[model samples]
Target: MFGSIWQYVYTNFLRYWLKWFIRQVTGKCELQRICSDYTPGASRTTRAENSLQASKNKVLRGALKTSRDHVEQCVDQIMKAKNIKPQKDPLFKGSLHICLLQITGYSSLYTSVEELRKEVFSSENPEHEAMLLKLWGLLMPEVKLECRITKQWGDIGFQGDDPKTDFRGMGLLGLINLVFFSENYTAEARQVLSHANHPKLGYSYAIVGINLTEMAYSLLKCGALKPHFYNTVQGTPELKHFHQLYCYLAYEFDQFWVAEQPESIMLFNQYREKFHDKVKTHLQDPDVSLTLTVGSY
Candidate 1:
């Protein structure tokens, strides 16, 4: 109770006075210090975001909500409000511009991801069907699928004969990630599929890939992926970047499952939670970059 009260008091009162004192002494705002102190990555971007969110000034706080195109204008407003001179701190404008881009870019990325997730898989869509078949061909190049709704789908780890039903929740987003990994990292995707085909330790490749899609989506939704994106992509992160992150999770999870060697597939949820926790732990680092290193298998 006391700790909570202390936090409330500190955030509401002491924090403002402390920042005021620091600004008076250093002639630099919190955002200025953040940009100067930390390099161009999550460390700087995250701190600048937090500082802007916590500021009493309207322009500073509004910068967080500014659109991607207007980020420069927002930065200018923030500089004007804080009395920051571009001539004096040459690097400050550029650094803060990048930070705002990353911050605002994250929101835009989530919007794109959410739109994809909402797109339900339709078998009637020739494009969707082609992508699904493409995934099978990429993973199982030699084998020919007998029919569209055959039991052969099991070879690639679909839960049922038709992979359409499995995408009810994650929708096209899941299929897109599956195809992205298989398309971009063909060798690694097949290697991971081989691991999934293991008798004892094997798990469903497509199903788990979709599950990891949900994981990636959850992390992105909750802003847990901000650091990873901020560290890796200097500017606005795009849909392909999100898919690449999914590729990393898919490959890494396969290795993790093979190493752990859980007794049976029924233990997947338990192990999935374990893997999720591990990824979350890694995201805690300021320099976390969860890219899948090709040829590492």
Candidate 2:
């Protein structure tokens, strides 16, 4: 309780001090007159309240501007303090721009992906368990199974009664991609899962799904997917967007594998690498964007 009280006091004092500082810097009349410009008919009390809010907003905008400048200054200072010389070569600047693009994009997209991936993969979470069940139900609607766990997991490609074991490496991210693909394109997901169970060239359904998740994660980590995100997403990318990327991979890989017609599952890595190379080649283009071509064979 004391801790809470102290926190409240500290927060209020800081807010008050910041507003006071802003008022002093901008001058009381200028800050107060901001709202009056557009609110000519407003009552005196209403104008006063508007002036207070406007002053706060002006302070916030000023602080944000300063904060951005401070960040850039700090970066320069750190580089200089470390005896680092700025790049002189044009080629080096181009390379640095590319690197910065990836670094910044990864910072925004990867953090959210990791958070969602962690939350969904934890076996102890009831919400994750429910989501798993829902994913199953969405895929295999005709076959009604009991709420309790059972061998019915095999219907969607798990090796055992409990499917969570399949998510060992990929975490919730794999399952989420699978679910997103299945839920959005139900027929497509089922068709792919059916092909996965083909007797001669069959692969583990959930296992391969998780592998594709890794592929998506790696592309994201190395900045290969930055162009796609930069072009496709207007602002910050989120977990759902990452899942969509996984969906594209899952769908595209199925097509590539079937078209290749490998002799056996033993050749999976070879074919997977080939597909990875193909994607990397595409990323080499400045105009490349990774949009899913649903139902386009």
Candidate 3:
């Protein structure tokens, strides 16, 4: 039903009416919003959830990434000092899960969508596969599993070669930068733009990588790291703003920001494009206007 609805909208209404609807909602003069309209969350089906559950079924449940021991200790301390038993499941499991995924790194996963499709769809592990799909969906809703730079690096390393030299000379940091600034970003591009909340998550997730880019830039500027972004986006003078925003997300402010506004976590990506601008903004300045779409506060 949902797919059919989307199909109908795509076939007819999307090009004509959707822009009007967006204009009504956002009150902006331009029809373009540089960001995907929808993004995944606990309420939405996502690719990340599917991948996460699959990892859990593979007996890697204990391995998800989380904050450092110091952070966990602080959390525990707060719980005890506040006399709050706290919700054990969401806290422990959620933190652990994020951590494990980070440690394993999305790059370390299957090198291609075909591998994931084959592994999960195969009959060898029906229940486990189902679980994996569920988890993956939560993390990356409708995210088309992909392979681009990161996967290229993975393939190189997997074939018993050194990543730095044997791989395409592009590492995670490189892939992260490519995903946003370059129009030629290959791997995750096609999938991210079309999916449900998946696109939104990709935008937000890219923030982490983009921020990493900023740090690499800052550090390099300070003679710390020998890396820099191409620093090119086609339009808008706001690229530097995005650099500042992302740098804050990766290092200085993620934890504090979350702590300060727990209620705003779900709408984490509501403000991304204002800083970085979108592909359309870079390539062609969109002139149509619409009302500003307010994200979750």
Candidate 4:
């Protein structure tokens, strides 16, 4: 009860006075101080975002929702509202512009990812069917699929004869990530598949890939990937960046699963949670860059 009251008091009352005092002492607004004090990337951008969200000024708060094309104008508006002159602080405009881009870009990236996740995989779509075939060819170059709806799908780690049913939970997002890893990191994807085919220690490759997609999606939806994207991509993050992150998860999770040598596939959830926790811990660092690095094929 007291904590809630204190938070309300702090947010509504004490915060503005504190900002006023700090600005008077330092001659810098919260945003300016944020950009100047912290170096670029997540540390600067995340703090700027938080400061904007807490601002009572409409322009400052609205800057968080500014579109990509209008980011420069939004930064101008913020400067005009705050009375920050380019002559006095030349770097502020560019720094704040980049911060706004990262902030708004995170939201935009999530929208794109969510749309893909909601797009159901359809056998009727030629593009979708082609992607599935491409994934098979990439992973299994030596063996041709006997048929589109055969047990060969199981050899690549789908749950049943047909692979389409396995995509129900994650939709097209799952398929795209699976194909992305195979397409970009062919050798690594095939190596992971080989590990998955190890009779006793083997787990379903495609199913687990989809499961890792969910893991990536969850981290993204919760804003846990902000540090990673901000640190890695200088400009706006796109869908391909998200796919690349999935590749990291897919490769790392396979290595993790093999190293542990669990009793059975039934213990997947237990180990999955452990790996999720490990990834979350890494994301807590401001310098986190979760990229998949391996030798070239």
Worst 10 residues of 1 by lDDT: 288-297
| lDDT values, one for every candidate | 0.94, 0.64, 0.31, 0.94
55-121 in candidate 3: lDDT tens per residue? 3122223323323334345334433432333352234423333333333322232122113223322
Lowest-scoring 10 consecutive residues by lDDT in candidate 4?
288-297
CA lDDT, candidate 3, residue 154 = 26
State the displacement of the C-alpha of residue 245, model 2, in Å, after optimal TM-score superposition: 1.0
Q: What would you estimate as the lDDT of candidate 4?
A: 0.94
Encode model 1's per-residue lDDT on 128-178: one tens digit a residue: 999999999999999999999999999889989999999998999999999
Cα displacement (angstroms), candidate 1, residue 187, comes to: 0.3
Clashes of 2: 1
lDDT of 2 by residue, 134-233 (tens): 7888778877877556987876778788887788777777788888888877778888888888888677777788888888898887767866665555
Off by over 4 Å in 3: 1-172, 176-203, 224-252, 262-297
lDDT of 1 at 161: 90
